[model samples]
Each structure stands twice: as C-alpha cells, then as structure tokens.
Target chain A: MKIGIHGLTSCYGCQLSMAVVKRILDVSEKFDIKYFYMLSSAGKIEHVDVAFVEGSVSTDEDEKELRMIRENADVLVAIGSCAIHGGVQSILFSEGIGYEEAFKTVYGDKKMDYNGRIAQPLDKFVKVDYRLPGCPPEEEEIMYYLATFAIGSWPEEKDYPVCAECRRAGNPCILIEKGEPCLGPVTVAGCDARCIKYGIPCIGCRGPVSDVSWFDSLAMSFRDRGMDKEYVKKRMAIFASRYEGLNEMIDKIYGD
Target chain B: MRYLKLGSRNIDEFLGRISNYGDLYAPQKISEKFYDYRKVEDISQVEFNYNRTITPAKKYFIPPKHEMFEFDMETGEYTETMGDVKPFVLFGLHACSIVALRILDGVYLNEYPDKYYAARRKAGIIIGISCLPDEYCFCNLRRTDFVDIGFDLFLHELPDGYLIRVGSERGHEIVDENMDIFEEVSNDDIENFKKFEKKRHEMFKYEGSFDNLRYILELTENSPLWDEESEKCLGCGNCTMTCPTCRCYDVQDLPDIDGKHGKRIRFWDSCQFRSHGLVAGGHNFRETKKDRFINRYVCKNAYFYPLGTSYCVGCGNCTYFCPAGIDFLKNLIKIRDVVGEVAHGEQ
Candidate 1:
C-alpha cells in the first residue's frame, strides 16, 4: 500500500511525532511510503492507497492541493487539530476578526498577497474518511487508529467527555475538588485526559463532543464555580469557536 | 456480631496476611484529595479515614468495561471471557458503600444472576470503616451510617487501636487467624463504640424526612420541580456513573473483519446520556432531560423499593462526582415539599 503524507498549513509536528515515535515500534513494514516532503526527495504522487493530510485549508494553493490529494487517494485522513477542527489560527477567523487586517497589523503595509476567505478543515473542501483530533494527535492514539485501519476496520473514536477517562484514571474531578473551571465535560476524550491528570483544566483542544448542548450551560457552570465570565467564554471558544451554531449559542447566552 | 481490638502497630501485619489470600484493596489517595480503590500492597497507603473514594468498590465486581464472551465464527468456536476469582478483603469501605453493594445485589443477582458479578461478589470480604461526614453526606437520611447487615467486619478507629465488629463467620475466621494481634474489647471500648455511633448520627444533618417518600414521589410526578432541576442536569451521566445503586449498562460487540473472532463487552451506561432510552426506531421514551432526571428519583423512591430493602443509601457519590453540582438530597427535599402540598389538598 502506497501512503502519502501531505501538509497544507501546519507545524509538521504531527509528522515529526510519527518519525520520532513510530521508529522505535518499527511498523514501517505495514505500507510503502510514496510521497513525503520531509522524509523523501519529493517523490511525485500520482495515486496512493492512504493519504494522511495534516493542517487546514487556509490558502488558494492549499485548497487546490487538497482537492488533488482527495481525488488521488482511496482513503483520506485528517490527522491533527488543524486538519480536523481548524487549528489555533482558525480561532481568529471564527471570531470574525479578518485575517487580512491582522496580517497588516503585524506586517505593517508590506504589500503582501495571500488569498483565502476563511481557514477551514479539509472536510469543508472535501470528504475526510477519518479524523484524529488533538493539537497534535497523541502518538498512542495515532498508533491505535493506524493499527485498526490497517486491519480494514474503522477504529472507534472516543467522542465522550474527557471526564470519563479522568474518572477511570482515578483522578478526582479538578473542577469539583479545586474549584477549577474544567472543560473536561465539553471536550472529547482519547487524549487520556493528560491535562486533568497533570492538574491543569482541559482547554478543549481536541474539539467538542456530543451530549454537550452547545456549551452554554457549561459556561454557566464555570461562573457558578467563581470563574470570570469572560474567561469562561474565551476558554469555551478556544477550539470549538468555529463549530457551527456555537456562535449563536454564545449570542443567546451573552445577549450580543 | 463479635468484637475484636487490633493494636494500631499490627494493622499492617493483619492486612498483609489477608493479601496472601487474594487482592487486598482499599481507598488510596492517588492524587491530592482524589481517592479510589487501589491495590494496597503498602499498608501505609490505605486511607481508612477518607470520607469516600471517587469510585466505589463496585468497579471490581462490575468494572467500567467488562468482556462477557468471545467467539470465533470461521472455526465456530466460542469462548466465555471469565477472569479467575480469589478471596478479596476490601479494607476501607464506608458504611454508605457497604449498603450500596447490598442494593446492587438486587439488580445483578436477581431472578437472573450475573455469573461474572456473582463470582466477584462472593469473593469479596467487606471490611467497613468509620467515615466522618462531609458537607455533602446525607447517608443519615437513608440511614446508611449504621448498617444492620452487609459487611464481614466493621472497624471504628480509636487513638490507640481499632474497635472491630466481626459481623460474620468469615470475619471471625480472619480475626481468629490473627488472635496474637487482636485482643478482647474492654468495657471502655464498648462505651467508645456507643459514643462513635451517637456522634455519627449527630454529624449528619439529614434535611429530608422519608416518612411518605413514595407518596411524595407520586405527588411530584407532574410538579414543575423536575423541569427546574433537570435544567441543571448536564446529561454527562457523572451522577449515574459514580452512583453505587445505579447499575444500568450498555452491551457492546467488538468484531473482527473476518466475521469470525469477536468479543462481547458490557460497559457501564448512564441514564443521563441521550442514548439510554433510545429505541430501535430512534424513538426515546424520556425525550426531555426533566423526565430522565426525575426518573432517577422515582426509581430510588418508588420503583425499586420492593426489589431491595432500600433503593438509595445516599452515599453522595452522585453529588461529589457530578460536574453540574446537582445535589440529590437537596432536590428530594424540594420535591417532598411539593408532595406535602398535594397530599394536604387531597386530604
């Protein structure tokens, strides 16, 4: 099986994670690498069995390349927070803060031309067969997805709140124990609750899960715990600001 | 029940000997303020004074996820996934949790007994310990502080030693083995036990009276209190998952691609989740969260009363674990007041 590694607009930390971590376990025998810009001398990619695409569609160039990769591959996987939920950069876009104005604010009239309307995940432009969501996909979770997919079966993604994993890990609810405004209830699991275990409240970096009714009530819960309302709103919107209807939910709760 | 006094110095020796039989587990603080049942290899880690563990002892009997069976379809071979059971001594179960386990006996070991749960249940020798009530405790309302039955041994910690109540033959046998470590209780020890019980009863400020709890549940069936309380329900199921009496589960199948080898597992499921009552055609019996929230109170009060001695022991695990901070006893009081009004009108 020919596998291609493609990056649109990302840190390439995910691919580095694969290289650094996957080398020790030695699972390279599963498939043959066709095209990886970082790994190889830029091999031409005609077609591939599985194409792992990282990063979001933030540029015209990224959009065109994503379509070609989607058309060429049998299975397309969005492998990172950027590719799955539109990374940290996409927060600005969701807040209706134009990237052009911000870019000018930083560049100071450099007369640069970068053309893209809204930064979006690959699924917005083309279909994504599977999504491995995290700021950078955790190594063990990536291995789980790969091993299951290699066997021709869809791996079960943990779509529940992080509190499930937190409880099983025997970690006390930091939200309750320390009066911390934790996002464990609103965020997806499968990061093994790394934040909660380390005594940090969840930042919702893996994106939202089901059963949370648009996170408005969750914000109110934060306020009840004596957290600043502004901080609660900002924290809730950290990763899930771009999620559809979330803005409307925020408007309803905060009243514009 | 018999009494045995164990020296504080020999607590480890007695517990370590019990470990030879099987796993000896107790409440341990793995993180700061977060306690759960962990293997008590080091006797010093045993948190006998902890108010409650984040998870109850139920995790051992009915784990969060348990594999029931495995099947090989191609060769037509079947396998029942069963783990070996050995005698266990649960060292630090609170009175509330001891009662909670008895409540679960009604569900798992009812008309159709769960073989997996039954094996673990029979293997465990419960040793209840005294727990000082936190602000959230309402076990007094449920009268779980003083258990008439359920445990093999009950330990009340004194400054110098442990005042032990040997409730069963197993408790006696265990104590009899370590007669060198245990001494006969004196008149002062008996007086101390009485004092402890009185203080425990006084510690709990049980807000709700259970005189007509069933009638209260019936009266509040149409009350708008459910709607208000349910609004606070996060639907995260933290309450149900942490609850000792709540025994609902979801069955899952992990199948191999060849249609041959597969494992059937049972995962702990909660009613607060959206999929709990969802039918095959996608119709949900309790569509609203209010209905689901009140269903818990109804089950605790009315539905499961005949099935067991009591539906709830009021362990307060639900309140401690719920992210939304929904207090069960507090809500019960609100509903009971509405019940009073309805009953008085009828009179």
Candidate 2:
C-alpha cells in the first residue's frame, strides 16, 4: 500500500514520533512511501493508498494542502491532537477571542507571509476517514494503524476514556483524591494514562472521545470541586477547542 | 476444618520456603495509601494490614490484557497463547476478595469454562488473612465479611500470633511442609481468635443493610436517582474495571505488518463505556448514561439475586477508586429509600 505522512501547521512532534518508531523501517519496507516530508525532501502532491495528515488547518495554505492530500489519498487519517481537535492553538477559538486579535498580539503587525485563520481540525476542512488522537500519537497506535492498513483491515478506535486504563493501571484517582482537575475521565484512552502514571493529572492532550465525553457533567463536577468555571473551560480548550459540542456542553452547565 | 497456629515472627521464613513451590504474590504498598498484589521478591515487601488493593484478585485469573490466540491469515491456522501459567500462591487476600474470587469462579468456571481463566485459577493458591474494615468497606452488609470455604488457609490475627484455619487438603499439606513454623492451637488461642473476630466486626466504620436490594431496585426502576447519579458519573469505567465480578471484555485481532500473522487479544471492557452497548449498525441500546448506570445496579443486585447471589462482594474498590466518588452502597440505599417513600405515600 502507498503511504503518505503529511504535515500542515503542526509542531512536527507527531511526525517525529512516527519517524522514530522502532518498526518505522519495517513499516516503510512493507508499504510504498509515496510522500513523507519528515523522512525525505521529495515533496510532491501525489496520490497514495493511505495518507496520515497531521496538524490543524491554521492557515489557507494548510487547508489547501490538506484538501489536496484528501483528494489524492484513498484513505486519509487525521493524526495527533492538532489534526483531530485543532491542538492548543485552537484555544483562541474557545476563549471567545478573534484570530486576528490573537495574531496581532503575537506577531505585532509583522509582514504577511500566509493567510492566517482560527485553527480548526482536519474534518472541518476535509473528510477524515479515521483519526489517531494524541498530542503526538502513541507508538503502539501508530504501529496498529500501519499494520491494520497493511493487512487490509482497520484499527478499532477506543470509545472509552483514559480512566479505563488508569483504573486498570491501579493508579490512585488524582481527581477525587487530590482534587486535581484531571481530564482522564473525559479524554480518550490509548496513552495508557501516561500522565497519571507519573503522578500528574491528565490535561486531555488526546482530545475528547468522539461523542461520549460528557463535558457538561464533568464541568459541573469540576465546579463542585471548587474549580473556577472559566478555568475549567480554558483547560478543556487547550487541545479540544474544536471538540464536537464542547463549548455548548460546557455552557449548558456554567451558562447563565 | 483443621486449625493450627503460626507465629508471626516465622512468616518471612514460611514465605521464603513457599517461594520454591511457585511465585509468591502478596499485597505490597504502592504508595502512601494504595496497595496492590505484586510479585514478592523479598519477604519484607508484603503488607499484612492493607485495606484493599486497587484492583481485585480477579486480575490474576483474567489479566487486563490477555492475548487469547495468534493466527496466521494465509494458512488460517491459530494457536492459543495461554502462556506458561506456573503455580503461584496469592497470599494475604481479605475475606471480601476471597468471596469476589468465588463469584468470578461461578462466571468463568461454570457452563462453558474459559480455558485461560481455568488454567490460571488452577495454578493459584489462596491464602486469606483477616482485615479491618476501613470507611469505604461494606463487606459486612453484603455478607462477605468472613470467608470459610473459599480460601485454602485463613489466618485470623491474635495478640500473640495468627490462628490458621485449614480449609482444603492443600492447606493441610502446606501446614505439614512448614510444620516447624506452626504450633498446636490451644483453647486460649481459639478464645483469642473469637474475641479478635468480634472486635473486627465492631471496627467497621461503614455499615448498611443490603437485604432485599434486588426487589428495591426492581420497584425503583424509573427512580430519578438514576439520573442524579448518572450526572455525577464520569463514565470512566473505573468502577467496572476495579469491580472483581465484572467479566465484560472486548476482543481484537492485532495483525503484524506482514498481513499473514496476527494475535487475537481480549482486554477488560466496561459496561459503562458507551461503545459497550453499540451494535454493528451503531445502535446503542444504552444510549443515555442513566441507562448504563441503572443497568450496573440491576446486574449487581437484581439480575443474579434470584440465584441467591448479588454478584457484589462489597469490597469497596468501586467507591474507593471512583474519581466521581459514586458509592455503590449509598446508591442502593438511596434507591431503596425512594421506593419506600413511594410505597408509604400510596399506603
């Protein structure tokens, strides 16, 4: 199968993780590498069997590139939190701030290079066949996606939260016990509760699990735990600003 | 039942000798407040007075991630991957946990027996020890506070040492093997053990009655408490995963990039997870959180109550590990209370 690993406006962390995978060489050997800018400079908009597009569509250029990849590829998988939920940069969208104001504050009227817009997930611009969500996708998930595609099968997405693995790992609940604003209860599983294992609560870098996140319920619980309503909203907006029904759900609990 | 006494000082030596038989797994302190059953490399690591482990002993029989079989796509051949399950002694189990294991035995060993669970269960030896109930524990309410037949050997702590009650032939063999460490159970020792049991019963800070819970749940099927509790539930699956009797699982085929070879694996799944009720056509039977929440109560109380078992051992792992702090016992009582109010008003 022809494979393309493309990046739009990401930190390149997802591509770096994918590149350093122990079985990347083996995976490359099995599939036809049509395009991957991280691995090579043969940057060509080419057709591929499976395309793993990372990063959010933050600029017009990114949107164009994503659309091109979608048009060429038979299957386009949105990889990492950036492509799946618009990353931390999408915080501006959820914070009720305009992209131009935030851009001006950061760039301070610098000379134009590319058309900048409020960052949005890949699905907002193009049809995403599947999504591999993480700040950087898990190595096991990366391998699973590659292997399943190789065998003409599809990898099953996790519909459960991080707490599934967290509880299984026998880690103490930081949310209830320590009163930490742990998002493990709302975030998708598959990072093996990595942050929680290290005694840190989850910041929900993997974004919400498609439809069953229960943001309103979690927000209300967070309020009961004495967290500021805005603080909870900002924390959720970090990687999941573009999460489906996230703002509405949060508003349902905290809105006047 | 045969009874013997083991001096507390000789525990390390007895554990050391048993290491030759199989791997000795005992409760070891993970953090300041948490304990888990871990492979004891050193005898000093064993914690005797732990309240409860994060997960139940069911993890030993049905691991969190179990590779069921490895299959070859080209040849259509598969091999069951039940690894070399060596004889292992699971030491320091509490009464509630022992009862929970029996509940698991009913599920995995009855009807069509799970080969993997049976293999692991056969390899394991249970050594029950008395534990003081913490604020979360409600084993007394569930009638699982004292185990007599489930464990091979049950140790009740006394002022001087431990009074060991041998339940199985294996327990007798163990006593014979470590005869030097044991002493003849005197009448004073038996008297002390009985006194210790009475004291332990009074030590439980949490108390409740779960009698007729099935009927109460049945009557309060449409109670608003379900919605109230479901709102607080994070749907994290912690309660189900930590629950000893929860046997739900999801199977997956993990293929190597070669496309010809793959392994079929089963992992612990939760009924609370939205996808648990998702059928092939994407029709979720339990679409609302209230449905899933109420289903758990019904499964634990109503579903199997007619069979003389509630399926809940009241180990308190669910309440203890819940990020949302949804207490199962409290919910049951609340549901019962709601039904009582409605019945009283009608009268």
Candidate 3:
C-alpha cells in the first residue's frame, strides 16, 4: 500500500512521533511512501492508499494543501489533536476571539504572505475517515493504525474516559484528593493514564470522547472543587475547542 | 476448626516459613494514604493495619490486563500465553475481601469453568485477618464482616497477639510445623475475643438493613435519583475497576508491525463506559449517563443479590475514589425512602 504523511500547521510533533516509532523499519517494508517530507526529501503530493494528515487548517494555503491531499488519497486520517480538535490554537475560539482580533493583537499593521484564518479541524474542510487523538499521538496507537491499514482493517477509537485506565493502574485520584481540575473523567483514554501515574493530572490532550464525555458535568465538578467557570472552560478548550457541542455543553452548567 | 494463639513477635518467623509453600503477598503502603497488594520480600513490608488496598487480591488471579494468547495475523494460528502459574500465599486479607473471592469463585469456578481463574484459585492460599471497620466499611450490613470459612487460616487481632483459627489442612500443617510458637487458647483469651468482637461491632458508623434492600432496589427501578446523580457522574469508570467482583472485560487483537505476529489481549472493561454497551452500526444500549450509572447499582444490588447475599462486598472503593463523590449507601437510602413513601400512600 502507498501512504503519505503530511503536516500543514502543527509543531510537527505528531509526525515526529510517527517517524521515531520503534517499528518504523517493519512498517516501511509493508507500505510505499509516496510523500513524506519529514522522512524523505520527496515532497510531491501524489495518489496514495492512505494519507495521515497532521495539524489543523489554519491558513488558506493549508486548506488548499489539505484539499489536494484529500483528493489524492483514498483514505484521510486526521492525526493528532491539532488536526482532530484544532489543538491549543483554537482555545480562544469559544471565547469569541477570531483570527483578525488575534492577529491584530499580535502583529498590528503587518500584512504579508498567505491569508490567515481561524484554526479548524481537518474534517471542517474535508471528510476524515479516522482520527488519531493526542497532543502528539502515542507511538503504540500510531503503530496500531499502520498495522491495521497494512492488513486492510481500521483502528477503533476508545469511547471511555482516562479514569478507566487510571484507576486500574491504582493511581490516587488527584482531582478529588488534591482538588486539581484533572480532565481524566471526560477525556478520551488510550495513553494508559501516563500523566496520572506520574503524580500529574491529565490535561485532556487527547480531546473529548465521542458524544460521551460529559463536559457540563466535569465543569460543574470543577466548580464544586472551587474552580471558576472560566478556569474550567479554558482548561478544557485547550485540546477540545472544535469538539462538537462542547461549548454548548459547558454553557449548560456555567450559563451563556 | 482448631484455634491457636501466636504472639506478635513470631509473625515474621511464621511468614518466613510460609514462603516455602508459595510467594507471600500482603498489603504494603504505597504512599501516605494509599495501600496496594505487593509481593512480600520481607515481613516488614506488610501493613496489616491498612484500610484497603487500591486493587483487590483478585488481581493476582485475573490481572488487570494480560495477553491471553498470541496468534498469526494472516493464518490465525495461535498459542496460549498463560505464563507459568504459581501458588502464592496471600496474607492479611480482610474478612470482606475473603468473601469477595467466594463470590468470584461462583462466577469463575462453576459450570464451564475458566481455566486460568480455576488454576490460580486452586493455587492460592488465603490467610484472612480481622479488621476494625472504618466509616467507609459496610461489610457488616452485607454480613461479610466476619468470615467463618473460605480461608486457609484466619488471624483475629488481640491485645498482644493473634487468635488464629485453622480452616484448612494447610493451616493445620503450618500450625503443627511451628508448634513451638503456637499456644493453646485459655478461658481468658476466649473472654477477650468476645469482648473484642463486641467492640468491633459497636465501632461501625454506617447502618442500614439489607433485609429488604434487594426488593426496594427492584421496586425503585425508575427512581429520579438515578438521573439526578448521573448529572454528577463523570462516567470515569473508577468505581467498577476498583470493585472486587466486577469481572467485565474487553478483548482486542493487537497485530505487530511485522504483520505476521499478533496477540489477543483481555483487559478490565467497565459497564460505566459508553463503549461497553455500544453495538455495531453506531447504536448504544445505554446511551445516557443515567442508564450507565444505574446499571452498576442494578448489577450490584438487585440482579446479583441472591440467596440472601449481595454481590457488593461493601469495600466502599466506589464511594472513596469517586471524583464526583457519589455515595452508594446514600443513594440506596434515598431510594428506599422514596419507595417507602409510595408503599405507604398505596396502603
């Protein structure tokens, strides 16, 4: 099978994670690399069996490149939190801050290069067959996707919160015990609760689970723990701004 | 059953001798406020006064996650991945936890028995220990506070020693092997034990009757409290994972990047998870959080309560670890009150 790994507007961390996977040698032997600028100098976007697209559609150029990739590949996978949930850049999206206000605040009277827009998930511009959610997707999950693709199967996303694995690992409940606003209760889990195991709370870098992550309940929980509405909203929006009905869910508890 | 008294000083030496039978496992302090079951390399690591371990002793038999078998991706040829099963002496199990194992035995050891669980169950040597009930404990309500059998040996705490009850042949053998340390129980010791039992019973803070609990739970199936509490439920699935009798699991086949090799692994799955009730074609049986939240109680209180016993050992891990602070006993009491009001109105 032929595959392309493309990066549009990201830190390139997700692509880097996939590149440094321990089983890359075995994975490379199963698929032909058509376009992967990170791994090879080959930059031409051609027809491929699967295209793993990283980062969000932040610029007009990014949208065009993403559209071209979508047209060329048979399947498009939104890789990482940036491409799946708009990453941290979209944290201000729910705060009613648009690209114009953000750009003017950062770079006044400066107009150069490509047109900038509010960052949005890849699915906003084109169909996404699958999603690999994480700040930078886990190596094991990346390998799972690749292995499934190699064998003509698809990967299944976990619909449970991080607390499922976190409790099994026998980690203390930091959210309840320390009153930290850990997002483990409403975040998609596959990282084996890595952060919680190390005495750190989850930041929900993997974004929200599909239709099940009760953001309103968690926001209320945070409020009960003495966190203000804005604090809960901002913390959750860091990796899940583009999640469907997320703002409305939080609004139900915090009010409009 | 024969009773033997052993002084506190001889515990380490006795444990050292039991190492011949199997690996000694006991609760060890993981942090200031946490305890976990760990293999005892030395008797000093055992914390007999611990409240409860983070995970139960069942983990020794059925691990949280394990590879059941390895298979070829293309041909589907497989080989069992059950590593060498060995006997282990689990020391210092609380009475409630010992009863929890009995409940698990009914599930895994009857009818078409699970080979792995059966193997581990047969190899296990349980040494139960008496414990003082804390606020979270409700084992007395469940009638699991005091164990008569189900253990190889039971150690009842005394002022300066343990009143040991031999329940199995192994327990008798161990007592005979270390006869020098064993002392015959006297009339004063028996009197002290009765006084100790009375004191332990009076210390229980939580109180409720389980006589009509199953019936009340069955009648209050549509209680509005289910929805009210679900709003506070984060659906984190911590409660079920920490539960001693929750045996639901999810199996997955992970293929290696080599594509030829893969393993079918099983991991603990929670009913509280949205994926647990999810079916193919984007349909979920328990779509709402209320349904998922209520499912746990129904399974524990109504469906599994049979022959006058509850599936819930009342370890209280659910209430303790819950970030939302959903108390199981409080909910049960509320539901019972609501049902009682309705019954009174009808009469």
Interface RMSD over true interface Cα atoms for each candidate: 4.0, 1.5, 1.4
Q: Per-residue lDDT of A131-189 in model 1, one digit per residue for the tens?
A: 87777778767766665555567666654577777775667788888888788887777
lDDT for each residue of candidate 1 in B268-338, tens digit (9 for 90 to 100)? 77776566777888798877777788778877765355334457777778887778877887787777667
* Docking quality (DockQ) for each candidate: 0.27, 0.69, 0.71
* Residue B67 in model 2: lDDT: 92
Q: Clash pairs of candidate 1?
A: B73-B260
Return the TM-score for candidate 2, rounded to 2 decimals: 0.95
Worst 10 residues of 3 chain A by lDDT: A167-176
lDDT of 1: 0.76
Interface RMSD of 2: 1.5
Better of 2 and 3 by lDDT: 2
- Kindly report the root-mean-square deviation of model 1 from the true structure over all alpha carbons: 3.9
lDDT of 3 at B31: 65
Q: CA RMSD for every model?
A: 3.9, 2.2, 2.1
Which window of 10 residues has the lowest lDDT sum in candidate 3 chain B? B301-310
Give candidate 2 regions above 4 Å deviation. Answer: A247-256, B204-211, B303-307, B341-347
Name model 3 segments beyond 4 Å from true. Answer: A251-256, B206-208, B303-307, B342-347
Candidate 2, A55-170: lDDT as tens digits: 98999999888989999999999999999988998888887799789889998979688888998999898899999988899998998999999988887899999998987777
